[model samples]
Target chain A: MERLNRKERVAAILKILSDNPNKVISLSFFQENFSMARSTLSEDVTILKKVVEDIGVGSVETVAGPTGGVRFVPSLREEDRQSFLKELCESLKNKDRIMPGGFLYTNDLIFSPEITNKLGIIFASYFRDKEPDYVLTVETKGIPIAMMTARYLNVPLVIVRRENKGAEGPTVSINYVSGSKRQIQTMSLPKRAVKKGSKVVFIDDFMRAGGTAKGIIKLMEEFESKVVGVGVFIEAKTEKKLVQDYISLLILNNVDEEREIIDVKLKNN
Target chain B: MERLNRKERVAAILKILSDNPNKVISLSFFQENFSMARSTLSEDVTILKKVVEDIGVGSVETVAGPTGGVRFVPSLREEDRQSFLKELCESLKNKDRIMPGGFLYTNDLIFSPEITNKLGIIFASYFRDKEPDYVLTVETKGIPIAMMTARYLNVPLVIVRRENKGAEGPTVSINYVSGSKRQIQTMSLPKRAVKKGSKVVFIDDFMRAGGTAKGIIKLMEEFESKVVGVGVFIEAKTEKKLVQDYISLLILNNVDEEREIIDVKLKNN
Candidate 1:
């Protein structure tokens, strides 16, 4: 084994911890990799913890005692978060993004991995306290952000499809009225997707009346799982909502077809 | 400002580099943040570059000359890749994964952020030399994997939808035959998704006859862009394929519906 210096050891430790975020990494693992003493490894951790905090990108927390080690929890500074949201809102204000029938052309934004990954980290930071067992999303548009959130949380992502293809194995389907169009729609989940009593956090790209959010709650009930929280990238301002008490990163105040304008900004929550 | 020691500086540098993979970071940025001299930062980078390679998780490369510094490229060792694929194939061999048709239920696996994130790094490593401008995928099942790949590659993800939704702005739609069902289907992309003369990579969860891959090639041509490569998580073994030049992580030989058997293994490539 090569004897690594303090700089090399700290770099290796940071890489390992960042690679496996939210997972406890024991000092022995570092000791084995770097051929370092426990006390040296502890000093490296201390340095890492302080630097991470000062940077405001994330943090390293000590678990304490036996069977506990260090965990990396990713986070964004408040100013950084605000600036990102501001940039997103500015991009979304493009007149071309306003489609007919009050729909905002957010497909590009939602598909952009860089933006979605940041949004996922923000969502994950908010729910890190909840320690969700799984991140759930209705299929198609929401999968990217939901997958990132699940990645940060170190959990599986369960996607409920708008239609059930037999390839998903046995499934449970549900019907819910579309909150915006008031049209009846169906959603389905595979039988083996989630375990009973699993704590799930629902994530979606857009919430327009919260009908889909309400439907997900019912869908989770079929699996005997609980939805501890709901998070959406963009929630439209609505007079009535089928579901309430959800976190939204951005709010769509209005989409004026005649004026070709979209009013979107970061939510106060 | 607190003066960071060598260990603290190295840890902070590693975290920043890992967080923004493939993006060049100047030494001045580190110097400004860590309050370290240029020579010290350079030495730290050299140490990090070697340790990252020694670990086989990834590597840090120093870009020479002015306006350049360091870049982190994530990679997986052959042994780690083989073991991960072996475990994945084993889990896929579950009897319940076989559906009524020859389809193997892989929704849960593809939806898994951890698995998908790993797969993304593998795919990104393969195509990093190509320097793809965009990663593309069709809507529904392939979003999670594509999103992760795009994230690792540090590029935007452009999703082609199965149908023309007006919300996508003006889109260019194309007709292609589904390789499995032999049914004619429509796929569309917004006009603004990709720029002309851009390089693109197509990613998907599964490949039946490579029809979708072929369609993506044709769709990219519509934007005057080129499809540089196609990557699929699982490729069904077939004598005839619509597209031949592509990469697949796993080869799914056959699915015996009656016997409830699925033969899947990691591809040699």
Candidate 2:
């Protein structure tokens, strides 16, 4: 809800595209949509190209005369992604972000196409060479970024639902310990939802105990496929345990069910 | 999932903007993501500007000089929107789009953000002026465009569920006849989910017998809110019904229940 400054705005915009990983937008197209002065946007574009490159997940390139604008290509280093996600985890602990079930409420950011799109782009850049066969996300909220990122990657999305739809198919389902609740919960994905030997990117709106992520990892393995990477819209590791090779956009620092003093952080690359 | 030609691609992108009423994109920013050569993108921008104007629901203008690009501000004439929707209905009955359930399957367009975004933009352009307080849709698939349009209008989204959730307070429940069977089915939304005096835009992924949309409309009125407009990702209206005042992005015409022939028509305007 806070207004983004020029620097943040540019970062945010680029982040949206990077996060999008779906359809790429022409720079001129963006200039038209955002309605900023051409020179200002040009300057911002220049800065974004540099920042994204420095971050190491990707590079934003400006296409030349006649038909080109800027397009972010995947060029990220794995270390950078890890560090960036680490920073993200730190920013998610804000008291305001605490929700029921010890979940870090990142509704504000996940619901934001701008922010979510950038996250998509970042992943796109991070995983470009890998080329995952599909994207996986769970029910309710994760659908946004999962759908957005799938668009960027040009792949189909398979959703894991807590309940099965008789219409979808008979399925392989799992009941896992939900970290936030420390209670086991059931979720399922259709057997045909994903194919074997294909590369996949696993993502979700939030990752606490990593139970769902791990469950999905196993489910994906059932297809005999490889997990190219894991990304979370927000990470609350301090509130729980985490595994390696996962990306978290934001993190939670401290919490108080009573006073609710909170701190938030973003993974720094 | 299908490849887009130049004109279709351009139209699709513009449609995304128009789909969300208050959404905007910077032209330069757009150019960067698509990897388009500037000149070609410029021309595409020009065409988008012109065609959208002709549609009368909005105007696409250029912010010139070093930083400027095109921006679409919806000022669409109501008559233009209505007639465009009318023609859309006629085309939907075509044979190419038929699927099971007298329903017109528009999965082709719905699956493409390029198309959905544009449709969202067009609908937003028309509905933003209506000053709707919230965008409504039934759960599962309908959530995407609903979220997109809500973001465009900078409003909250309230989703209806076929069943009640524990987190939601006492719910306002209603029933309507579904095509799945002539038998009536129940639907619900939280008691505090919507505010009174709010203007609502009803959105759905599919509209068959107009069951879900009508149920949603009734639910809103129970909250003392008005159903300002109804829009569907896909519409299969054979005969104009009392509920046809709303609009649809794609129309499904003539249905062959036995043989299964569905036709699709996109908005001609």
Candidate 3:
């Protein structure tokens, strides 16, 4: 194989690193692939890191150790994040999106790949340092964003199904009260879905009183795993929250059922 | 902005294109972003396309004329695809994945971002030319794969919930029989999830008798949309299929319940 020039090497390194986000690629891996010396590869890494940080696309962190290497951490510009969230808030304010029972219709917004992808990047960037073993979410609406977050973090996504079907083999089911509705709801997960003592991040589309989020925390406890962080795309403002210490991209202020109005704004955080 | 060298330019182009797969990016847009001439941008794209194709990472297609530009279509090497699908078959062969009603446990596999991402790339590559308006699936287990396919195709994911909730606003409901058990089931989609006259691709985690796929086709009809393609990660071999003409990566031949054996193989296609 012909040795690649610095320019070609840099381009190839960026492609490989970005594709496998948050994954550490050893210096030797790049060295052997590019047929370059350690010193040369180090120089390449420096240039790539500087360029990436300068461009505000992402950051490349180099770990110092025998087994350590460079890892790409994706990040969106603050300006870009604000603008994207503002646009999302706008799109979510349509009158027709107001459903019955003071619920706001956000399925389309949550399911749109373009919107979900950007949200994933934002959420992943926030939780990058957590280094979760998996991104967890209950089945249904939240899977898209949760999957994207897992993608960017280069981790597995474990979904806690609403009900375990026979196909799941043996499952662990738990009944939790919906904090908002105060109704008992059951959520289940296959025993093998998650490993014990693993660290996980919980993500979902909406958080109302954090009943489901609380349920997820308890569920993770059953697996002997720890929920490192909880993130939601939208969190409704309530008189009280069952679970605090969570992050939400957007805050829903109020829903006027009679007027068919929804008030949504980007969270200050 | 400072001028970036050929190496930096190529790296940036690859990142942007790969991130927005199956979407045509106009050259002028790249030119403006990179502050490069049309000729320079064209050369950069050429280098990217060649490198991508040579490495079997993906393809960069250039469309000429007024509305012409470059599009990145993701692909996996034949060797990579075969190995991945084979490993998946091995993991899925566990007898524990079999349910009492001859159903197979696949929620974990489908929910795992690592496996789902690879499957998404494969499905996206197959339907890249289909130019789907949306990627559709019934809710729950299928959401992850459908979301992934939607991500790769750069389209919105429209999920058909098993039951319509008050939060969905107005929904279109349809009754269909579960082919395997001959039980009637209802699937519903929010009225505004899709647009009329749109083309869509249906993706799911499993297909026993293709009843759900048929239900999706009927649902799309209600929306006045067309299902351009159907893709499933696994399909069980049955005496008869409710719907044909769908692509499946793996085929489940049989599950001997008494012997606790499960048989799975990769689809030749």
Candidate 4:
């Protein structure tokens, strides 16, 4: 490898840290790769930290001790978050998105890689203090956002299946009432999925009565794990929620099928 | 904003490009953000490109013409790809992973964000030339990897459901036999999900007999879209496959429940 100047070195360091968000890359690893002195690498890290802060994307923190290293903590700028949430609300307000049963067709939005990636970072930022061991979500709609959150947090993603399949070995199935449908539904997970006493964050695309979130709480109990946090993209207006203390990016006030009006806005706006 | 030196400017530019993989960012956008001369910004990009190449992660590509811009094209170095796939095969070969009915339990591996993130980048590298309009997968296991691939490709992810729900508005449903189970199953996708004449790539965790892949091909036909490529993490040994010309990372020879042994290896190794 050729000798790289400070400009090139900073760019390389940022790229590596950004790729492995929340995962520490040892200083020795960088030193071995770049063939730079410890002090020089430290100076480069300081410069990189300042650059990331100036850009308002996130911050680079240095850990102390034997395993100490540098990590990139991702964050969305305040103004960027506001504008993004507003634009998302505007998109959801499109009348065509309202279906026959007043369900908003959010498949395109939720499945969008760009949108979910940002939402994941937002969710990660909110739950980073919890130091979650895993990010959990049910099958289908929530998986993308949950997967993104896990990626940003540098944790594994655990998906609870709607039903038990023969291939998953021994499984634990739990029955929970659907908040909106008022019907009993079964959700299952492989017995080996979550570790005992692990802390997990639940993330999903929508929440109506928070029944699923509650269900997750009960399911986590089977493995002796804890649901430290919950997050969703949209929370629909409901008379009551089964669970509380969850972050939602958007609130859906109402979807008027008759008038073809959909009222959605950023949460707490 | 404070004026940034060359090192800081290079770090910021690299961060932006890395975050928006494969999505072109105009030179003017960088110029406006950095408040620097176009020539100077170009020099930073050039330095960043050389730095990325030195690191062997990927390349910074420059597009020409009126819509010209720079984009990050992520790639896994050949050695890294080989070692990662090899490690993945070893993990799968654990005798405990063999469940009843000769099924190998893979939820932990497929659901892992770190593993799936790398798999996504590898898949993106393979299908980037296709310029896929969307990365498509069925509900459940494949969503994580598919989402990652879409993120890396800078495209939308479209998930097909096993059953149609009222929330998706109008949907097109089709029945395809499960290659391994040899049972017919249904898959449905909303009409608005895919655009006409667009190209898409199908990604999944496992492929046996390729029935699901064949079904995806048929389903895409309903929307007048083309299935340009297929990629999977594992492919089981079978008499034959329903579809041809797909990429599989690992080849699963057998899962011996009686002997508690699993035989899996890297594809074409």
Error of 2 at B246 (Å): 2.1
Off by over 4 Å in 3: A1-4, B95-103, B257-260
Displacement of the residue B109 alpha carbon in candidate 4, Å: 1.4
Tens-place lDDT digits, model 4, residues B12-46: 99999999999999999999988999889888888
Looking at candidate 4, what is the lDDT of residue A193?
91
Tens digits of per-residue lDDT, candidate 2, A93-134, equal 446555544444445455555555556656655565678888
Off by over 4 Å in 1: A65-67, B65-67, B258-260
| Highest TM-score scorer | 4
Question: What tier of docking accuracy does candidate 1 attain?
Answer: medium
- lDDT of candidate 1 over B151-182, digit per residue (tens): 88999998888888677678899999988779
Q: Which consecutive 10 residues in model 3 chain A have the weakest lDDT in total? A: A1-10
Candidate 2, residue B255: Cα displacement in angstroms equals 6.5
lDDT of 3: 0.86
What local distance difference test score does each model get? 0.87, 0.63, 0.86, 0.92
Q: How high is each candidate's interface RMSD, in Å?
A: 1.7, 13.4, 2.2, 1.0
Give the TM-score of candidate 2 (chain A): 0.64
lDDT of 4 by residue, A183-251 (tens): 999999998899999999999999999999999999999999999999999999899999978999999
Best by DockQ: 4
Cα error, candidate 1, residue B155 (Å): 0.8
What fraction of the correct interface contacts does each predicted structure contain?
A: 0.81, 0.05, 0.68, 0.92
Model 4 chain A weakest 10-residue run by lDDT? A1-10
Q: What share of the true interface contacts does candidate 3 keep?
A: 0.68
